[model samples]
Every structure is written in C-alpha cells, then in structure tokens.
Target: MPALRLLWLGCLGSLCRAYFDGPLQPEMSNGSLHHYFVPDGDYEENDDPERCQLLFRVSEPRRCGAAPGGLSLRQELTVLGRQVEDAGRVLESIGRSSSYDLDGEESYSQYLRREAAQIGDAYASSERALSELESKFRQGREPEPRDGARPGDACLGLLLRARALLR
Candidate 1:
C-alpha cells in the first residue's frame, strides 16, 4: 500500500548515521585504552601507592587506610568512642570527689555515665567488625622505629603530657 511505502520512506529519511574518516578511538594506540590516561602521567603514577586508583578509572588494589572505609561508619564511631571514653573517664573521675558540690553536678555525672554506657553499647554491637579491622590495621600499621623508643610509646608519652596539661 502507498501508506506503508510512505511510512518506510519517512522513517528512512528521518534516520541519521554519523561517519568519521579517522579511527573510532583517536586516542587509542597499541590496541590499548591506556592511551587515554597514559598521556597524563600524574594519573598513572605507580610510585604513589596511596593515590586512589578509583579516581583514574583504573582497577588496582589500594590501601583504604588503617580502617577499611567504604560505607562503614564503625571506624569513625570507634575513634569517637575512644575520645569520649577518655574525656569522660577523666571528667567522671575528677567529679567523683564532689559530685554534689555543684548545682548541676548530679545531672552532669548522670549524663557522663549514660554517655559512657552508650559508647560501651556501641562497641559491643560492633565488636566483631571492630576486631576484624583491628587485625588488619595492626598488619598495615607502620613499622615501629628501630630505636629504643616505639611510635606507640612516643604517642602515649605525648598523650600523658596532654593529660598533665589538662589537669
């Protein structure tokens, strides 16, 4: 029928095709797509292992850091929990002597105790995950100095000085 012929002609007329004299992938060379990023050596730098390969659209193993971080907030909460426990322990210990001396001292004590309890609960909930991260972190942790002083000891010494300052 003329209607069917017209429809086919119209469809063919509306359709379009693109063509280029050069190759499909201009940047491609040596039959590898690496040409795209190879020009910018910054992205393909093999020396910096810390650089996230994901940014370069490259599939390579990367150290996400001391904590395995991908949508997991446990590591963040753990750090917060440690800070909370330390400060709360110091505050609660200091306030124990005269918890009733201040007007809101009772409420303060209750609040700190409740907060510490909550932190404990959080840790208990993520104990398994936290333990797994702990092992991985210990393995990835930087080697201690060959000298007599260890990095952890040095950090602890600094923390002790900071506590002394707080007192």
Candidate 2:
C-alpha cells in the first residue's frame, strides 16, 4: 500500500510540474512572457497594512496590481503544489505507520489531523487567490499575464486527490 501511495505521489508531482510549468492556452495567454522584477522601492511602498495582514494570515494574497502583495499565477500555483506535496507526505507517513503497533497512535493521529486541516485551509486560500487573479485578468484590471504558465485543472485535481488521501 505504501508503495502504491508513493507511486501515485510521484505521478502526481510530475503532472503538477508539467502543468504548472507549461505554456498557457490561447485564451489564458496575455502575449507577454517577459519576467517582471519587483522594484525594491516599490516593494516597500506597496506593502499596505491590510495586504500585509492578509499575507500573514493566508500566505496568499489577492492583488489586482503589480504590487508587493501580488504574486504571479505561477508563483501561487507553485505554492499550492508545495502544500499538496506536504500533505501527501503527511498522508504517506500515516500510511506507513498504520501497519505498526505504536504507543503514540492516538497522539500521532491528532497531529496528522491538525496538519491535514492546516493544509486544507492553505489550499482553499490559495485557490481563492488564484480565482481572484483570474477574475482580475478577465476584468482587464491586470493587462498582462503575470506569468505565461497557468496550472489550470491539473494542480486543483492533484490537490483534491491529496486531500482525499488525507481523509
């Protein structure tokens, strides 16, 4: 079972990397693949108190502009992918340990539950941020694609599968 879980995780990771790093579809493309470096001064000035608070709480902030709080779609998807990976690791650990008779099973189960909840919350928050950025693009608030790559359905599917494994 553990081997099967590891195999699944490996496949999911590959799919995530391919999808997140791949080119965007025609409708999602903004025709600008150039990298935008955040200016030092602008980074400091654009750090609004509210935005900082949101960043602290959620780790993903919805920004309609090229400000310090704004993260490219690729960046956001990368973060989501990492979260999913972490969750998968936790699930894998639980599976491996389930076969052994351990004294700390109860406590370990609690810890796993907390970790899973945290991962779920972070996933939802990042998902919301992605949706908001997409909406901004649709509304013309963001003229160019922050990054030419969009994770699209692949990342979300992986996240959902990971979450299911946790359960």
Candidate 3:
C-alpha cells in the first residue's frame, strides 16, 4: 500500500507539469505591466523573451488602448491550473484501466491515491484563481471610468470572468 501510495503521488506530478505549461504571467488590469507582445502572427526582430522592450505605460483611460488579446499574467496562471486538472483526470483514467494488472496492487493503489490528491490540489488552485479573476471583473464594473469605455472592454472582462468559471 505504501508503494502504491508513492506511485499515486508520482502521478500527481503531472498536475505540476500542466500548471507550468499554461500561462504564467497575465496582463495587468491597468496596463502598468505592459509590453507589446507580438500579436499571434510574425515574430518581431530580436524578440527575446527576457528582453521584451517596453513601449510605454497607460495612466488613464485613453492611454490603455484596446483590451489586451494576449492573456494577462494572472490569466496565464489560471490556465495552467486548468491544464493540471485535465492531466490529473487523464492519469486517474489510466490508473483505472490498469487496475487489474497487479504487478503489485500496492503500487497501483499508491498511484491512484496520489493522482486523486493531485486532482484535488489542482481543483483548489484553479478555483482560487477563478475567484480572484471574478473579483477583478466585479471591480472593473464599479460605475467608474471603465464603465464608459469601449464595449470591447466590457465584453473581454466578461469573457475572462467566464473563462475562470471553466475550471
């Protein structure tokens, strides 16, 4: 059973993998954490990840420009949590399918336990991220300057709120 436990725990590592692979840094709400990430198409000259040059910063509504299509740093982290949860599911299913092959039932049992823990952890992390995202949206709607901004801002904010819900 202890061996099985370890195996299960090992499987949970996949969650970590998924979390890291997804987005890490999200866009800032105020665009203070701003940098012109190359929009989906062509890579700019000398576009090094570490050397992304800053164009400018937004201090007011007009300066903010369009709602960033690129996911924000926070959003990227949330996406990672979702991916981790998905990986956990895959691992659980795999374990289920291989349950009878008791090369060592003990090891198998451990694997299952580990995978389950991973899923739970992933779920919790994702939920926390989603809650934060939801809060951000609600804050965005507080009858202020953002209220009169372009409709796109509202729509994107709503989309982000919904995406957080997906987890």
Candidate 4:
C-alpha cells in the first residue's frame, strides 16, 4: 500500500515537468546593447522603449543570440518519466537549491512550504497556457497580428518564445 501511494505521488510530480516558466524575451539588434539604467517610469521622457540601447559594458558579458538554456519540450517530457520514477531525487534537489530552503531549520521548513505553494500556483497557470498553445499548434493557426506585423514576428522573431524557453 505504501509503495502504491509513493507511485501515485511520483506520477503527479512527473506531470509538473510540463509546467515551466516561459522564456525571457531574446535580445534584439546588433551593435552595443543599450539600456537606460533608470527604472521604468523614472523619467517621463526616457519612458520611451526606444531610449534603451545596448551598451558595451566591459564587466558584463554580452550573450549571443543563441538557443535558450534547459531542456526542450520533448526532452522535458522525456525527463518527466525519469522524475516520476523517483520524485525525491528531483524535488529534493530543487528544494535544496532554493534560497528559501537554506535559511536554517525553521526557515528551511517555511521555505519549503512557501515554495511548494508557489509551485502549485505556477503549475496551474502553466497547464492552462500550455493547453491553449497546444490547441493552437494542432489547429495549424498562425497568429494574426494585433498590430500590422505578425504576432511574434514583431516581438521576439519567433512564433513561440514560450516554446523556445523550454530548450
């Protein structure tokens, strides 16, 4: 009975690998990367997104427009099976790496609880988003531009930055 329960928990945890935060917007433009040091809305005039330009900072390493880090969707789904085999191995490591989990015994416990709650919330949201995306993919629908330009073409130059973030 205990083993069966463990297996159930493992299966549930495996489902979570499909839920992940989407990728950050890839940097665009060539030449130096520009950014206004000021926070958004700090200056009314500087509020223009165009104001920001990539600056060549000697200390900060510039990232090339390469693929995103982490597993791709298929890869992640594949790993999900391994994780289901032993949720402890994956979940325990993730919990330990979190800062919340490192704040001493009491804090660690609190952190674990808090992080678990956060993960649950995030998982729900990701599931919903993924479902919508999957439907769109299956329908073979192209994103119509809200503006004149096509959807992601104007934004990230990729149809799905969210999908790219998976890799």
The best candidate in terms of TM-score: 3
RMSD of 4: 40.4
Better candidate number, 1 or 3, judged by lDDT = 3
| Residue clash pairs of candidate 1 | none
Can you tell me which runs of candidate 4 are displaced by over 4 Å? 1-106, 141-167
| Candidate 1 residue 45 C-alpha distance from true site, Å | 58
lDDT of 3 by residue, 76-103 (tens): 6899899999999999988877775644
Descending-lDDT candidate ranking: 3, 2, 4, 1
Q: Candidate 2 vs candidate 4: which has greater TM-score?
A: 2
lDDT of 4 by residue, 34-91 (tens): 5556556456567555565445533323354435784666786788887786887778
Candidate 1's C-alpha lDDT?
0.65
RMSD of each: 33.9, 43.1, 40.9, 40.4
Winner on TM-score between 1 and 2 is 2
Q: Which candidate is the best by lDDT?
A: 3
Q: Write the per-residue lDDT of candidate 1 for residues 73-162, one digit (tens) a residue.
A: 676688879999999999998877556544354576776787788899998979978899999999889675676876589789999999
The models' CA-based lDDT, in order, is 0.65, 0.68, 0.73, 0.67
Kindly report which residue stretches of model 1 are placed more than 4 angstroms away from their true locations once superposed: 1-72, 99-167
TM-scores vs. true structure, each candidate = 0.17, 0.23, 0.25, 0.22
Error of 2 at 157 (Å): 99
